[model samples]
Target chain A: MSQFLDISGLNARIDADGQEKEILRGVDLVIPPGEVHAIMGPNGSGKSTLSYVLAGREDYEVTSGSVSFQGKDLLEMEPEERAAAGLFLAFQSPVELPGVNNANFLRTAVNAVRRARGQEELDAVNFLKTVRAAAKELGMSPDMLKRNVNVGFSGGEKKRNEVLQMTLLQPSFAILDETDSGLDVDALRIVAEGVKRLRSPQFSALVITHHQRLLEYIVPDRIHVMAKGRIIHSGGPELAQQIDREGYTKFLAEAA
Target chain B: MSAPLAVTLEPFRKQLEGVSGQPQKTALEALHHTGLPDRRVEDWKYTSLRFLAGSVFHKPGKNYDSAKARAALAALGLAEGAVAELPRLVFVNGHFVADLSVTKGLFACSFYTADKAEPGSLVRSDREPLAALNTVLAENGVVISVPEGIDAGQVLLVSLGQADSDAVSYHPRHSVHVAKGGKLSLLSVQAGEGHYLHNPVTEVFVAAEAELRHVTLQAESDAAANLSTLYAQIEERGNYDSFVVGIGAALSRHEVHACLAESFAQVHINGVQRLAQTQHGDITSVITHAAPDCISRQTVRNVLDDRARGVFQGKVLVEQIAQKTDGYQMNQALLLSGQAEIDAKPQLEIYADDVKCSHGATVGALDDDQLFYMRSRGVPEGEARQILIDAFLEEVLELIGDETAREVCKTVIARRFPVSEEGA
Candidate 1:
């Protein structure tokens, strides 16, 4: 009966040298639990800014609007606080932390979220066991756990690392920020399957992507078309097929 | 004695005369006029000892109680009876405690004692003014020698300072010699509590075909000031490696001067300096390739938080005759707070046209995107920042080679990060 995540009239801007450029203008979105929604947009369409704003990056200023996650005021929380509240963002260009080993970093992250939820921390053995299984399902090698997080990894490996984190954290709501952008065909299939395995009645996803090719594998329940910082169209999965066929030329003409 | 070398040497000589015999005291007095290193000094510009100009010096104490020394040793976490197995040497307030030193094989007492017993046999050379200061003022120090074709276990040298008086200063000296075909590992630790100053100098000589691994751990008190200088000479076909880890003291400076005197010698120097609050730490090194086909690599990492400051100055010189030399140097610093400062300068002076020499320096905070990436993975902000910091310093720490030693350094580094025990 309640919305899992509700964003109403969200506005974001970037200030470069005394000038303010609006990135998001009066954007509204809603997604209930147990549903997957995709937002498809061209380059520089403010899709990444929306994800960053929702994740509370300090650089993006939210001029006005409200985002409620699980009935909690999302904007009022720090990025870490949002994460502890079961909010996840699968970055498009996941960062490479050279010195921190993958296993140790994952364990620390998982336990941090758990402690915030008033749960006991997992011991090292138990944590390693869980990570090993999840890493295997994501097609990650054992050596990946020993290496620094994403350091020297290929583009596809970084995407898999994000999926690995999602599987480990098991967050209630996840925002996949173009996770399929640089992945190969096999990696895309594996990542889509990883998301599919995580699907549940209590879990929801806001997948930001540009291509409908990924939708063929993940199969979003609904699709939204975003242009110039606002969603102009919302429909069933058929909308994705239509965009893939006709392209954004007709939509650009209509908006004009 | 022909108008003592410098005015600063007068008080130091008078102090040494009261603690030891004639020859030793005279040798120390001979080092007098070596001008005090100031900001104007080329190598000492970034680190100035001008603050020491006004301070009065204290003489070495004669009535050091063994029981008190033993208690201090235990507090440092040395296992009981561990000293007996170690080729151990102890210094109290810059003066050597002969009763506590154990020497084996070619290892003897101080250089003066060693030379007196066998003239022209000791490896002795004069270069730095501070080395002369340590010799003249040092009442107690060590001379360690490893015979040819022998592998000596790790030798532990502990320098302890007791500041029973107000603002006392001590200069300790050491001499180490490794013969041809010999292997040696030395752990030199400087620790003390009180308002005191420690100025220590060590000279090491590695013979042809010898290998030496040296580790220096400086954990002096926050109120103490420390100046340590290490000078090593590597002969033909010798290998020398030094790892210096600094974690304490209000003001500390470590200088390592390594010279490859013969062809085909190799040197590796790695250091990590972690400072917080009002602490100041410096790692300055100069590697000279006087012979052909020499190789050298240096990596220095510094982590500064609060108002702490760190300085790294590295210089690699390839002489004209030293063709086919390979040298690489890098210095990186992580500033956790806005007030923290890091000054790093990597220098290269190469005259050999056929040599490969490169140096780089970087000073920065944690990556913003990396921080958000970790935070989005459910890691708290503090923990996320710490992970990034750890990753930044991991490259340097991984060069330690020893797993246990690396782990110990890792623990110390982790504690430096702002992580609660509950979070750990």
Candidate 2:
């Protein structure tokens, strides 16, 4: 049987200025059920591309390879199907929808997933109660729910909002791409804890980040060092500090 | 048929043979001179009157199928709701239906049959061909007067057209007058079934310090053509606030001529059109700032799909003496399909240098990033698109100050365009 989440010989490319530029040369990674994996790499290393490819983003064309999630071919699913199958991607830069109410959007998304999973949808009263408790736990103001989705939100708030959505969506496999980059120490801790709360035997995640600060709060079961569109080395959770202090220079040399 | 009839004013003029009103006689003479406008006319550039060609629109008879009218009302959610409780003026086939109407309200209301109808003073029939057509063939109408210092709550003016095998057309002439210090809100709903033409002309006179909130919901039959014209004259400190929502018709155009005749008056002409299939919708307005300190604001939005076409033409003319006139106009369109089209023309003629006038337009499709973001969160592509569309129109709907009117428009739009069940 395939692993809980698996990627083998994955290659992807994007069209930039009418020219095809390969982003993911050959990415191979795996994570068993209930385990958290961290992929730390410098800029231009195709770290985010791996997350996008897994989320079924249409911009990137996967030339070769296979991705299996829970015994299903993940790449064959649409983005929404991926979501309904318990996959979520925390964007590096959250999009702003000017006139969509934050609370309403959250409810619609949550109910959409629930409906697909054959779960009874939550009504307005229950949804408001659940979302209110979630927001308060994230230290978010009530007014944020009334405003447009992510419009005019601060960087920290946008990140927290992403976490809010991740918490509400309750995805089985989440790919958080630099979700802690613009966050402060307190916000980073809250977001990490939000993810930690979802850690269980049924849950798995891939945390992609530049700094090791986030890993300190939500330490991973394994850490992989990626360079030039490939994961070159991996080890236990201790590898995060090694790469954090010494940087990817050693990994780049070793991969070369 | 003996030699296919030419598409001209001949059919319409033939009906005017025994028309006794002097205004009708004069309007017929004008029609003989100018004829119907084609695409060559600057105002009629984007819209075509060729839809009026083959079908000979006969004057609607007095009787109508009440069941069909009831079904139409049910479609609008007006059969039972807060809106149904309001005082209503019901007209079927252009003739007033007393049993179906409830006219007990705070205002003085009267009806005019085609022969006894007195054309209002506001229309310039010589210049506008449709207005001239309405003057000659208007069969039924409503005359509403709000007394001074009285706040008339709300009134419903409904026109439902039901045409059978023989295509029928009706021109309903309506006039609204608000005395000094009076306040009124008018919600006009136009709906119909089958092949027909609905051409209505309304004259509004707002006395000094009075207010008239007019909202029109044009949900015509898919096979019909709708041509409606409105004229409003606002005196000192008076307010003429109007909004038109167009979601139906094979071809439709809503034209408004508003004049701020005195200082400090305000006029707002805001509207939205949601068209699909091969539908065509147009909104054209001319606001004349005749006195200093008058304010004119207009915002129109269009959502088109399939091979639909949308048009917006707004002209703001500020007179030489109208200094400090604050005028703003904006038109935007969201094309949901590759074949959809939108034509926007914003004109500003300011003779006074001290006036402040601005106009802008934007056309675009739904942002892919926004769609992806929503889909990434488990919302299906179709539902995500619908959410974004509602968000796009929510900003404009919020501008409607009257709660009931806004709710009615929202209900109508939601019923007309529900969430798509299939994914993209």
Candidate 3:
């Protein structure tokens, strides 16, 4: 059987003021269906760059890499095509689309994905039913859905909106890009609960974070330490505990 | 300094004499000697009519046939036999076709005929020069008057454009009077498939404690040129709302000017202009506060795609006596293509001590992050861009209080942004 998401020798660079800076160097990772993997890294370790490359952002140039999702070439597809193929990336900093109502935008996105998969669009009644339930589960108020997407929303609300999109789209594989950064303890628990509700054999997630606080709630099956543009260590969930106890001081010295 | 005014006064004087009614003709002639508005004219700087220096246009003759007028109306989806309950006033090349107009209790005949009937009435005799120019040159105009304390139901004024074998120029005049304690709603639609020129002037007077709502939609042929001006005066305790939506012509200029002449009056103006290809559309507005405790809000949105160009110039002025005045203006444009251009200016001039006034103008392309966000949701790039564009313009469309009118405006904007075609 094919892996849910596979990345082999993924290399990336940043061009700054006429000089090339290597960010991700030959990073290899494999996420099988139904498993949650956590990637813990220090700053400048290319955690965000990996998410950008996976989501097909224009600025990031993948120097050398192969990314396959569910037996399809993920790197070749457009960002939207990747979304339709059940690949989702919960952005670290959710974008604010002023004047676009949150409920209307989510419905459009859901219908677009449905249409791509040869499915009929959801009517207003059915869409409201699905979204209202998810919003309730995520502790989001009904008024939040009526407002412009993420505009003037608190950091916690934006993270909740990301989770709301994840719940609405039901992607097979999701990349949580430091979604717990600005959230308080309560918000982090709510988001973790939202992810837990969506967990199933057909679903998988790659959680990229700097701290082990989020991993405590989501309970990843495995943890990997990344430094100096590559994954340096891999182990079970205890690795996260060790990192939480000792911090990245030892890892930084080794990386240097 | 006065030499240019004298030079400009010659043709206006000649045109004033051609105005029929004695009192109106005399007033126009006197104003003509005062001189034509030039660059010195605060409002005429951007739009100089010096282009009409040597051109002579004949006053339209009443040689229009009822059958031809009906045909023109039918072509505009306003068929004669249709069961729609709209008060339709048909204008053939700026002349009113009485056979096609439906006038009831409050709504009267065209402006010329109304003025002829009610010559000494306070409303008819009070005419400006541009209005007088429209009067002498207009083949026909419409008047919708709501009596004191009476609510005038929705009124739809349809300006039909009918071109004879010879190219023609038309100036259609419209005057709306809302009496004290009255309410009025008017939808003015200008539709024509001819290659003629249409210059329309509409004046609205809202009395104390009255409410008036005016919605204007213009969809002239691509080969036609349209110039529309709307002037409104609001009295004490009155409310005025105006919206203008235009799917651009070869050259389209729409001007809306409103004066809060009395205390406790309010004005709201919202407009949208959509242009494609070589089309040029301009929307200019001025709101003045002459009395204390008045409020004004203006929002204008323009969408220019392909090689189209759009212009929006808005101003809000509050005099010293107009204390406690609150004014806000926002003008935003979406340039879909690199070649498309937009010139937007929002100005606020307040001489009052205790007044709140602000203005903002922005011209930009679609947000790249928002575009990526939409694209990442499985919407194609073209569709994503179109969605953002629609959302951008919807800010203005939402100001229209009527649902049907807002839907019509949205449909017209959608057609201008075709997802299947590039640079459209």
Candidate 4:
């Protein structure tokens, strides 16, 4: 059977100033349908870069290899096309769009994705009704839908907003980039629950985080240890606790 | 003035002949002295009226196509919308068409002719060349006066310039007066077709305890040059709130001179300019706080695309006696193309000992992070850029108080710069 997401020999570099810095070096990873996976690594290990490359951020140049999502070349698609193809990324730092109403942005995004997926677009009234429910489920105030998108929102609120978007967009694959970094325990549970609620035989997620606390909430099916632009080791979900206790020094030394 | 400057003023100078009003003669003399300002003049430093050089702009004659005028009105939705119900003073070219106008009983409106033109005391024709030019050649205008303690709701002042083959010029002089405790909202729309010059001078007087909300939509033809000047004086506790949206004209400038003459008075000269494709738009204002405890606010935003260039020159002067004054000015520009340019000069001159004054200017392109965030959420790249552009302008557009005027400005702006294009 075809893999849900397959990244093999993927090498990506970013042009910083006058120098080219390789962020992803010959990395290979795979996630089958109906499973949640996590990547834990130290700083500068290119965890976030891997997620950005998957989401089709233009800043990174894919020097070699390929990312195939559902048997299609994902790297060839535009960012919006990837999004419409059921891929979502919960940014580590969600961008603030001032003067852009949250409700309007969500409606536009949801409608665009829906239209691309050959579904009917949601009108204003129906969209409001749908968004209000999703926002409520995420324990967010309805007023958040009226304010500017992520403008003046707390870190936890920004994280929840990402979950709200992920919920509304209904992506089959998602990448959570440190979504629980600044989130409180409640917010973490809520975020993890948001992911758990979408888990099915078709939906899969790659959670990039530093702590095992989030893994305790939505225990991943597998955990991968990434270091120096490559995933060096992989184990079962219990590997999260092992890494949390022993740290990545053991994994790095062993991989070396 | 150089010989070239004189050549530039020669067309207007010819029109000055056979005119005999004292104000007109004085304005003509001032124009001859200053000629038409060039890039050398400090006031006209960034703007050049060189487009008028050697171009004969005749006075708009009779027998203009009324059908075209009506069509322009229809384009503004004045023929059938909520704005259509408001009392509108329609000017085809520079001549007022009473048949096309509907004057109501809520406010007193009169048409003043050039033969009887009385330049108001608020404007300084000797110092400003455009005001002088307007004074010298102004043909006819509407005089609106709201009585004391009365609220005149809203009125529409529409100018439709339809120049077929000839490059015509129309100078319409308008004035507004609100008595103490009175209120009025004026929506001025400038739109038309073909190549022409629309120079209009408006004088406004806000009495003590009175309020006036004015909004101007300057959407002229792509080949036209619009040089409009406004002079307003606010008395004690009065408010002069105005917003100008510039989205048209090959070259255009909206200059405002507002004076807060008495204590507790307020004046706001807020505007936005969206230009594309070699168009040049300028918004220059000099606000004076002459009395203590007065307040002045100015915010101007510009969006330039292609090879368009935008200019913002704002000067806020607080006199020595205007202690305890409050003033704020912000000018921001968004350049969508590398070739597009914006020149912003925000000047604040305060002689007051105890005052709060702040001014800031920012020039930038669209935020790539914001664009990517929107696009990654499934919005097309073109639509994402459009949304960001709208958001950039949304902050200032919300300051417009009148719903009809605000909606009209939004409709016109969106019509000019669409929300999204297929490939844009």
Regions of candidate 3 where Cα sits further than 4 Å from its true position: A14-22, B1-83, B98-110, B113-133, B164-166, B415-424
Residue pairs with backbone atoms closer than 3 Å in model 3 (clashes): B95-B140
Q: Kindly indicate the candidate among 3 and 4 with the higher lDDT.
A: 4
Q: DockQ each candidate and list the results.
A: 0.78, 0.90, 0.60, 0.91
Which DockQ-derived CAPRI band holds candidate 2?
A: high
TM-scores of chain A, one for each prediction: 0.97, 0.99, 0.96, 0.99
lDDT tens digits, residues B1-424, model 2?
Answer: 1233235665453565566678887876676677888899999999988888866778888989998898888888776778887899988877889888898863798876667766678998898888988898887799999999989989988989899897888888989999999999999999999988899999999999999999999999999999999999999999999999999899999999999999999999999999999999999999999999999999998999899999999999999999999999999999999999999999999999898899999999999989999999999999999998998888898888888878888998999999987843
Q: What is the lDDT of candidate 4?
A: 0.91
lDDT tens digits by residue: candidate 3, B165-277: 54456777677889998898777777675566678877788999999988888877776778787788999999998898888467777877789999999999888888888
Stretch of 10 with least lDDT, candidate 4 chain B: B1-10
lDDT of 1 by residue, B1-424 (tens): 4454454443344454443544444444445444566677787777766545555667757657677677766655543444345666777787667786665532433443423422112213244566555655654457778889788766777888777656677876677888998888776777777777788777788999999888777878777889888888999999888888898788899988889999999898898888889888999888999999998989888988889999998888889999999898988888888999988878889898999888888889877888778777778777676666666677788787654445545654554345643331
Model 1 score (lDDT): 0.79
lDDT of 3 by residue, A1-256 (tens): 2777889999988787878889889999988899999999888888888888898887777889899899999889989889999988999989888778899989989998999888899999999999999999999999999999999999999999999999999888889999999999999999999999889999999999988899989999888888878888788998888998898888777766
Ranking by DockQ: 4, 2, 1, 3
Interface RMSD after interface superposition, model 4: 0.5
Please give, for residues A174-240, the per-residue lDDT of candidate 4 as tens digits.
9999999999999999998899999999899999999999999989999999999999999999999
Between the candidate structures 1 and 3, which one is better when assessed by lDDT?
A: 1
RMSD of 2: 2.1
